[model samples]
Structure formats: C-alpha cells, structure tokens
Target chain A: MPDATEGSATRREELLAIAAGLFAEKGFKNTTVRDIADASGILSGSLYHHFDSKESMVDEILRTFQEELFGQYDAILASDAGPLDQLEQAVVVSFEAIDKHRDEVAIFQNEAAHLLTFERFGYLAERNEQSRDVWLTLLRNGIEAGVLRDDLDVELTYRFIRDTVWVAVSWYRPGGRRTHTEIARQYLSILLEGIHCA
Target chain B: MPDATEGSATRREELLAIAAGLFAEKGFKNTTVRDIADASGILSGSLYHHFDSKESMVDEILRTFQEELFGQYDAILASDAGPLDQLEQAVVVSFEAIDKHRDEVAIFQNEAAHLLTFERFGYLAERNEQSRDVWLTLLRNGIEAGVLRDDLDVELTYRFIRDTVWVAVSWYRPGGRRTHTEIARQYLSILLEGIHCA
Candidate 1:
C-alpha cells in the first residue's frame, strides 16, 4: 500500500491538474477557488489544505511549467549540435510542450500578459525576454554558419517562427488526426525548404 | 458648413471607432455601453441616438470591417492574376488590413469565438469557413500550376499561413518601424522560399 504522505502528494498533483485545465478554459481571472474545488468534487475548505488560494494554484502551475520548458531550451542551447540542428531541436521541443502541456501552454499564451502585471509573476516577463534571446542566438548562429539566409531579418523571422509554432496550440488537439510530431515535421519542412516547387 | 446629417454621420463613425478600441482593449464582454459613452464624452442616451445597444455598435463595427475586408479578398480571387501572384496578393491584403484596421483585427481575434455563440454573430462562423476556403483554393491552385509543392498538406499549410499573418495583429502597430508592405514582403519571402540559405 502507498504511504499516506505519497497518496496526499498524488492528490495535490491531481488538484493542480484540474485547476490548470479550468484556468486554461476559463480565463485565470474568471476561475475561482470554489470552482476548482467543485471540479475536484471536494469542499473549498479541503482545497485550502493543498493550496492557499487560486493565485497560489496558478503560481505553482505556471512556475512548474516554465521551469521544465526553459530547462529544455537550456539543454538545446548547450548541446554541441550545429546551429541548424539546434534550431530544429528548439522547434521540436516547443511542439512537444504544446503536446504534453496543452493546458499550461494555453494558460501562458492567454494569461501571461495580465498575470505579468503582478509582482509575483515578474519572472514571466523575464522568461519572455529569455525566449527572444534563445531564438535570436539560434538565428544569428545559423546566419553566421551560412545555414540560414544571410538576407533574413532576424527579428521578423523569429516572430514568424514563434507565432506559427505557439498559435498552433489554439487549433492543435493532443490526440487529433495529426500528431504533434507530424505537425512539427511539416512545419520544419516548410521552414527549412521553400514551399515553392523548384 | 457640413449638413447636420453629415456631421452626425462623422460623429457616429468617431463613436464607433472609440467603442472598437475599448472592445479590443478591455474585451467585448467586459466593455459596456456606459464605458463607450464615457469614452466618447457623451451621455449614454445621446450615444444610443446612433446605436441601439452595445451589441448594435459591435455589430456595425464588425459588419463594416468584414464587408470591406472580404470585399478586397473577393476582388483578389476574381482577378486574373496567377495562383502564385494571387496567394502573395492575398497575404499582402491581409497585412494591409492589420495595419489599417488594427483595432478591428484585434477585436475579431479576441472576441470572435465568444461572439459567435450569439445569434446575431452567426455570420462570423461563416466568415471563418470562407477564410479557410479562400486559403485552400489558393494553395490548390498553386499546386495545380506546379508553383507550390504538391506534397504540401494544404490544410496545415493554410493554417500556418493564416495563423502567422493574422496573429501579427497582437504586435503590429499602424505606424510601426516597418510598414505593412515591408512586413508582408519579408513574410512572403519566408513562406515562399524557406529561410534556409540555398
């Protein structure tokens, strides 16, 4: 049998998952602690045992998600792979995030702007800058290595890549007809080779 | 001196512009007729002299914007331009829309899903289908003409194009450093020719 502490930890995680889903579907500002507790089939008082407030729940959710995502980016950046390979890996990792953490990705996309206004969420703004830096570094390296087009506007290119990949979360269903891998493959093809026929 | 009717018409247009900006900024659901009246520096009763309700104001705003935008798309589709030219022209027209009607573009992006649930906004859904059909037609024609790659997943390609182009409304400003034409050109270059150096 599982230890009582282990079972409680599992329950806490389950509650966070439920809260994350609600936060993603209903805007974070619109979701209440009671709603999360009700969704979990528990009393609001019981929820307080796991999380102090909805803000705490969301804070935990975003913090955990961003940490894991940035961790992957750091790994890709540190790898000895060529600049082109690193860029491709970065795109693959982003799509994987959308696939595995759909709710978290949506919450970040939809709520980060508003959430960043709070002192507690100041790190989100830094994460945004860090993300820009990652792409710019990959792009500049690619251009320097003579893999990416020399004439490309790095900023615009980064924005296009960023927008195209993340916005897929809006329409991309996890188990839908096209798997995220396939979607990433196709996007990479378009990004690496012109859609125009030779 | 302008006739009273012409003066009222200009004021009506000004009020709708203010309402659109608020709806874009605060979200359509959060914006109230009183807020619009306040923004216009007029009494709510005086505001209602032009529009029956907030819904009416939004309806007119969306209707006018979509009609003008879709009208341009129709012209491009009906033109004798080749499929490749047509695709490029369609993209150019879309960025132009973002530049010219930033508030309307944002309001539509942020509110269309919520607004579509109402009976009055039924046409928004149809407009969505029409947009899909427009892009698919362009892609199909390009494929048939041997200009675009035949192996492309037309639906996915369309989504990428649509997402990247329209999502620019989030960051695009009317008088930004780059003109809409320049942004469209760079985007088209990336879309048509892969960012990879030949």
Candidate 2:
C-alpha cells in the first residue's frame, strides 16, 4: 500500500487549495466549512477530518503563502545584488507572485486585517513587520550605496510600493490583456524613471 | 422660519452623512438602515421621509461626491496649467478631497464595485471611465509635451498613481501623523524622482 501519511498530506493540500479558492471568491466571513466541502466535492465531515475549522484552513492557506513569499524576499535580501537591483527584483518577484498565486494574494489582501484580530493569527502581524523590514532594508541599503535618494523617506516609500503592488491583486486578472511581465516592466518604468516627459 | 424644502434637503444631507460613516466603518452590506436610523436618533419612518430607501441614500451620497470631485477634475482639464502641473494639481486636489471627505472616499473605495453592478448605480462605471480618461490624458499630454519619459506606459502609470493615492483611504486618518499635503508631497517626490539615489 502507498504511504498513508504522504497520501493524507497531499489530500490536505488539495483541500486547502479548494478552501482558499472559495474564501477568495466569497469573502472569508461569508464562507463556511459546508461551502468549502461542497466546492471540494467532499462531505463536511471529510473536510473536518482534514481541518478542524475553516479558520484553521484559511490560517494554513495564508501562513503557507506568506512563508513562501517571505522566503523569496529573504533570499533576495541575502543575495549579492546591489540595493537598487534588489528592490527591482523584489518588485518583479512580487508581481510574479500576484500572477502565480493571485487567489492567495487576493485572500490575504481582503481578509488579512480581519484575520489578524484573532490571537491565533498573530503571525500576520509578524509577516507585516517582516515585509516592512525587507523594504526598509532595501531602501536603506540603496541610500547607503548612494543609488537611491538620500532624502527619501524609507517608510513612505515602502508603503507606497507595498500598497501599489498588492492592490493590483484586486483587478489583476491573469491570462487577460497584460502579461505579468509586461505589467511589472511598466510599473518598474514609472517607478524608476518617473513619468514626466523629458 | 426655515424654508421647509431647504430644511428637508439639509436633513437629507445629514442623514446621508450618518449613513456614509456607518457604511465606511461596517461596510455597506453589513450596515442596516435601522442601524443608520438608530445612530441618527430617528425612527426608520422619519428617515424614510428624507430618503425613499437605503439604496437611494447611498446613491445620493456617492453621486454627490463624484459630481463634485469630477467637476474639479473637469476644471483642471480646462485649466491653463501644463500637463505636469495639471497632474500635480490633480494629485493635490485628490489628497485634499480625501482629507475633507474621508468617509465618502472610504465608502466609495469599499463599496463602489458592489454598488456599480446595480442598474441605479451605472454612473459608478462611468465615473471610473472618466477617472481613467483624466489620468491618461494628463499622462499622454506629459509625454507629448516632452516632459515625461516617452517610454512610459500611460495606462500602468495611471494605475500606479490611482492605486497608491486611493488605497490610502484604508489607513489614512484625517488628523494622523502626516498631513495629507505632506503625504502627497512625499508621494509626488517618489513618483517623480523615484527612490533611486541620483
């Protein structure tokens, strides 16, 4: 027989994906275990076997996405790229994530504040801090390297980029008109070169 | 004695303001007309004397805000300022609006999409199109004026500016640490000179 533990883990991941989709499409407060199970074509009891509550499933879904995303950010920070290059890479990678994992990004964007209120989801605050640190570090490094404007407010810049990029998840439909690469390229253009014609 | 027509109109405006505040705080779908009436210390029937329905109240609230906002935009377009100057003024005026009419902005941001699907709210879609036109015109004019970089993608540039400024409604308290002007100035700096040290 196949490994029961491995098979169960795969099944758990599949169910989580289904739940994430429902939570994203329908608001988190509006979704329930019954909705998730129905969407996944499983009985509600079977879903309970995988996750104790919808909250638990959504918690796992968001936590996993954050871990993977922050891992990429951490690696970029640790890389040998210069500060400006690093910031650019971070933006590019972020847009890519939005394209690749649009549903997860959407869920986080729409539901994170509500989730963060619960003690069980305290890690969301940490992720927000970590995200801030990544941008701050990059901006500080750029200032140090004399590549970014010294007069720049790193906090404001971080918030600007963070808000601008993540908010795209709301209207960013993949396989639509603009490809992710094109969108990123366009954003980086305005971001780096300024939009004034000169 | 107050003119009865004018008094009723004033009362109607006050009720909408109360409803807008509640909608912004609790979200449109979650907010009930009863709650709004209770907050206003009036019975639902009394409130209905001013507004036929909750839908009509919201419709008035959003329509009034958009009309005033877009009137300013139209004036800017008709102004003698250069494209870059026009863009700057538009940004400043937007931030000013956010400061002066925050609850309206928040409600529009949170509920416009949901509201726009209804036949009565068709103008929301038109307002969006008008907004895009305003930004795109300014961007394209800047490019044609040879002030902004010719390579810039006007559409994406429009979106970046749009998202960055409007999403501030989520966290932008009117009397917070930074004045809207200060925040707008810093944002304009980053938008124009970018974070790159030069």
Candidate 3:
C-alpha cells in the first residue's frame, strides 16, 4: 500500500494531467476551475484543495515542461559530440518532447503570449531567448568546424528551424500515421542535405 | 481633376487598408468598427458608409489578395519554364506576396480558423487546398524530371514548405535589413542544397 504522502502526490499528477488537457483544448482564458473540475469529475473545492487557481495549475504545467526540455538542450550542448551530431540530437529530443508532452507543448504554443502579460510567467520569454541561443550556438559550432556551409545565415536558418519545428504542433497528432522520430529524421535530412538529387 | 468614381475607388482602397491593419494586429474578434473608424479619423457611421460591416471589409480584403496571389501562381504553373525554375519562381512570388500584402497575409494566418466557422469564409479552406495542389504539382514535376530526389515525401515536404514560407511573415519586416528577394534566395538555396558543406 502506498503511504498517504505518495497517494496524494499521484492524485496531484492526475489532476494536473486532466487540467492540461482542458487547457490545451480550450484557450487558457476560456478555461476555468469549474471546467477543470467538471472534466475531472470532481468538485471545484476539491481542485482548489490542490491548486490555488487555474493560473497556478498552468504555471506548474509550463514550468515543468520547459525545465525538462531546456535541461536536455543543456546536456546536449555539454556533451562531447560533434556539432552536427549535437544538432541532430537536439532535433530528435524536441520531437520526443512533442510526443510525450503533447498537451504541454500545445499549451505553450497557443497560450504563452497571454500568460507572459503577468509577471509570474516572464520566464516564457526567457525560454524563447534560451531556445534561440541554443540553436545559434549549434549552428555556429558547425560552421566553425566547416561541417556546415560557412555562408549559411545562422539567424535566418534559426528562424526556419524554429518555425518549422514548433508550428508543427498545430497539425501533429500524437498517434498520427508518421511517428515523431520519423518526422525528425526527415526534417534533419532536408536541413543537412538539399532536396535536389545530387 | 480625377473622376468621382476614381476618387471614391482610391478612398475605398485606403479604408480597406486601414481595416486590414487593425484586423491583423487586434484580431478579427477583438477589433470593432469604432476602432477602425477611429483609426481612419472618421466616425463609425462614416465607416459604415464605405463598407457594410467589418465582415464585408475582411471579405473584400482577403478575396482581392487571394485572387491576385493565386492568379500569379496560376500564371507561373502555366509558364514554359522548367519544373525546377517554376518551383523557384513560385517561392519567389510567395515571398513577394508577403512583402507586398503583409497585413492580408497576417489576417489570413491568424483569423482563418475563426472566420471559417462562419459559412462565408469557406473559400479560404478551398484556397488552402488549391495552394497544396500547386505545391504538389511543382514538387512532382521536379521529381519526374529527375531534378529533385525521388525519395522525397511530397506531403511532408509540402507542409515544411508551407509552414516555413507563411510563418516567416511573423518576423518579416517590409523594409528591414533583408529584402524579401534576398530572404527568398537564402531559403531556396538552403532548401535546394541543404546547409551542410559538401
């Protein structure tokens, strides 16, 4: 039997998961505590027992997601791999994040602008900067190593990669016909090699 | 000395331009006729004198933009250029569209889904399909000519191309550092040859 502390922790996770689904389906502004509770089959008071408000719940969701994701990028950058290998790993890990944390990814993509208006969610903007820094660093490393073309514009390339990867969440279904790994491989191939026949 | 009809036509164009800017920035649902009229230095009553409703204004804006854009695409497809040359021209013309009609592009990108719920915007969906057909035909034409890699996944490629080009509008400034032609050249070179040094 689980201890009381462990049991409540699991219950909290379950509640957060339910809340995330609602937040992802409905815009954050449109979702209320009552909506989360109704979907969770619980009373609103019970939800308040766990989270102070919907803001707290979404705050927790986005915070946890960004921490795990940026952590991976940090580790990849620190690794002893070549620049191209590191870049490939970053792309693969991003898709994995999309697959495993579909709701969190969607919420960030759809709701970050509104949330950033409040002081508490300022880190969302920081995360955007951090994301740019990571891509630029990787691209620069490749260019320096002469593995990637020196003429490539890192700024424009960064925007292309950023737009292509994140905007994909709009159409990507978790269980779609093509798996995330396959999509990543396909994208990386196109990025590394031209589409024209050699 | 201009005829009354020509003078009214120019004023109509100016009003629609102001309305498009508001719709793009504030969103279709958030923007009001009072706001557009205020922006135009007129009263809501006078604004309605020009257009029936905000809906009609957006309808005319999008219809005119798509007609001009798709007309260019149709002309490109019907030209005698080689398949590869035709594909490049389409990409160039698309970037040109983003350059010349930035507000309309943003309005279509941000508001298409919301407006689609109204039965009148159904053609936006068809225009999307037509856009896809144009890209696929160009890609297939390249593949059959043995200019592009046969192994390319045309559907996935179409999405990347679509996402990359349209999403650029979010960051593309009309007269910023790079011209749309320069950006188009950079993107096409990357798309055609990949970024890795051979």
Candidate 4:
C-alpha cells in the first residue's frame, strides 16, 4: 500500500497538473479555483485543501517549471563541454521542456507579461533576465572560442534563438509526427549549419 | 480649408489606427466601442459616424493591413527574383511590415486566434493559410534549386521563419537603436550562413 504522505503528495501534484491545463487553455485571469476543481472532479473546498487560491496554484506551477528549466540551463553552463556543445545542449533541453511541460510553456508565454505586473510574480521578470543571460553567455563564449562568428549580434541572435525554440510550443504536439528530439536535432542543424547547402 | 469628404476619410483612417493601437494593447475582446471613442476624445455616438461598432473598426484595421501586406507578397512572388532572393526579399518585406505596421502586427499576434472564432473574422484564417503557402513555396523552390538543403523539413523551416520574423514585433521598436534593415540583414545572415565561423 502507498504511504499516506506519498499518496497526498501525488494527489497534490495531480491537482496542480489539472490547474495548469486549465490555466493554459483558459487565460489565467479567466480560470477560477472552481473551474480547476471542477476539472479535477473535486469540490472547490477540497481543492482548497491542496492550494489556498488560484494565485498560489499558478505561482507553484510557474515556479516549479522555471526552477527545473533553469536547473538544466545552469547545469549546461557549468558543464565542461565546449561553448558550441553547451549551446546545442541548451536547445535540446528547451525542446525537451516543451515536450514534457507544454502547458507550463504555454502559460509562461501567454501569462508572464500580465502576471509580472503583480508584486508576487516579480520572479517571472527575473527569470526573463536570467534566460537572456544564459543565451548571451553561450553566444559570447562561442565567439571567444572562435567557433561562432565574431560579427554576430549577441542580442539579436539571442532573440532569434529564444523565439525559434520557445515558439515551437504553439504548434508542437507531444505525440505528433516528430519527436522532440527530432525537432531539436533539425533545429540545431539549421542553427549551427545554415540550411544553405555547401 | 479641408474638403468635407476628404476630411471624413482622414478621420476614418485615424480612428482605425487608434482602434488598432487599443486592440493591440488591450486585446480585441477586452476593448469596447466606448473605449475607442474615449481614446479618440469623442462621444461614442460621434465615433459611430465612422464605424458602427468596435467590430467594424477592427475589421477595417485588419482588412486594410492584410490587403497591403498580401499585396506586397503577391508582388514578391511575381517578381523575377530567384528562389533564394525571393526568400530574402520575403524576410525583408516582413521586417518592413513590422516597422510600418507594428500595432497591426501586434493585434494579429495577440488576438487573431480569438477573433478568428467569429464568422466575420473567418478571413483571418484564410490569411494564415496563405501566409503558410507563401513560405512553403519559397522553401520548396529553394530546395529544388539546390540552394537549400534537400533534407530540410519545409514545414518546420516555415514555422521557424514565421516565428522568428513575426515574433520580432514583441521586442522591435521603431526609431530604436537598430534599423529594421539592419536587423533583417543580421537575421538573414544567421538564416543563410549560420553563426558558425568557417
């Protein structure tokens, strides 16, 4: 039999997952605690047992997702791999995140701007800066290592990379034609070696 | 002295521009006829002298913008340029649109999905398909011409190009540090040559 504490923890995760889906499908402002509870087949009071409010629910969803994503990024940055390899690994990890956390990625893309206006969601803004820094560090390191072109505009390149990688969440389906690995590999190919044939 | 007819036409254009800005800033559904009239510093009834409803105002704004944009794409497709040049020109024209029609682009990005659900906004769905066909044709042509990699996934490439080009509206500010031309050039360089220094 499952431990009582483990059972409650699993149920909590399940509730958060249901809330994340509702938040992603309906705009965060439009989704209520009742809606999440209904979607989870629980009463609103029961949902309160797991989370106090929708704000806390979304906060946990975003915080947990960003923490895991940033951890992977930090690990890539700290790895002894060459700059180019680190950059490639970063792209791979991003697509993996999209595949695994599609709802979280969508919620971040759609809600972060509005959410950041609130004092509690200030960390979202910091996360944006940290993401930018991660890409810039990779690009700058690549340039210094003489692998990436010196003429590359770090800021624009970062924006391009960021846009291309994350925007995949809009159309990427988990069980769709291509796996996340396939998409990431193709994208890396185009990024590292232009589509122009030699 | 301004002619009455010409004056009304100019006023109509101005109102549409205002509506586009508001719809872009606060989403289409969130904006109301009174809000537009308020922004225009006119009574709601007087605003109705030009547009009967907020729907009409947004319709005019999006219609005019798409007509102008699609006209440019048709011209590009009909031009004597090679496939690669056509692709480059498409990117150039896209950034030009971002520079010239920032608010319209923002409206399309933020509200198109929601707006397309209405029967009146059905054309927006067609416009999306047309845009996809444009890119696919360019990618297919390039691959056939031996200019692009044969192994390229045209669909994914189209998404990448579409995302990278249009997502610029999120960060691109006209009269900012970089000219649209410069940004487009750098982006084209990255797309065509990759960032890797030979």
- Tens-digit lDDT track for model 2 on B58-95? 88888889999999999999999998899999999899
Winner on DockQ (2 vs 3): 2
Interface RMSD of each: 1.5, 1.8, 1.8, 1.5
Q: Model 1: which docking level applies?
A: medium
Instruction: Compute each candidate's TM-score over C-alphas.
Output: 0.91, 0.88, 0.87, 0.91
Predicted candidate 3 versus true structure: per-residue lDDT over A36-149, tens digit per residue: 999889988889888888899999999999999999999999999999999999999988888899899988976775577789999999999999999999999999998999
Docking class of 3: medium
Off by over 4 Å in 4: A1-11, A30-34, A42-53, B1-9, B30-34, B43-52
Residue-pair clashes per candidate? 1, 12, 2, 0
lDDT of all predictions, in order shown? 0.90, 0.84, 0.89, 0.90
What DockQ values do the models have? Answer: 0.69, 0.60, 0.59, 0.67
Tens digit of per-residue lDDT, candidate 1, span A21-41: 998877676677889889999
DockQ of predicted candidate 2: 0.60
Docking band of candidate 4 = medium
Per-residue CA lDDT of model 4 for A1-198, tens digit only, reads 445356455777888889899888766876777898898897888987777788899999999999999999999999999999999999999999999999999899877877787899999999999999999999999999999999888999999999899989888999999999999999988888887886
lDDT of 2 by residue, A71-176 (tens): 9999999999888889989999999999988889988987786677789999998999989999899888888888878786678788998999999987889898
lDDT of 3: 0.89
- Of 1 and 3, the candidate ranking higher by DockQ: 1
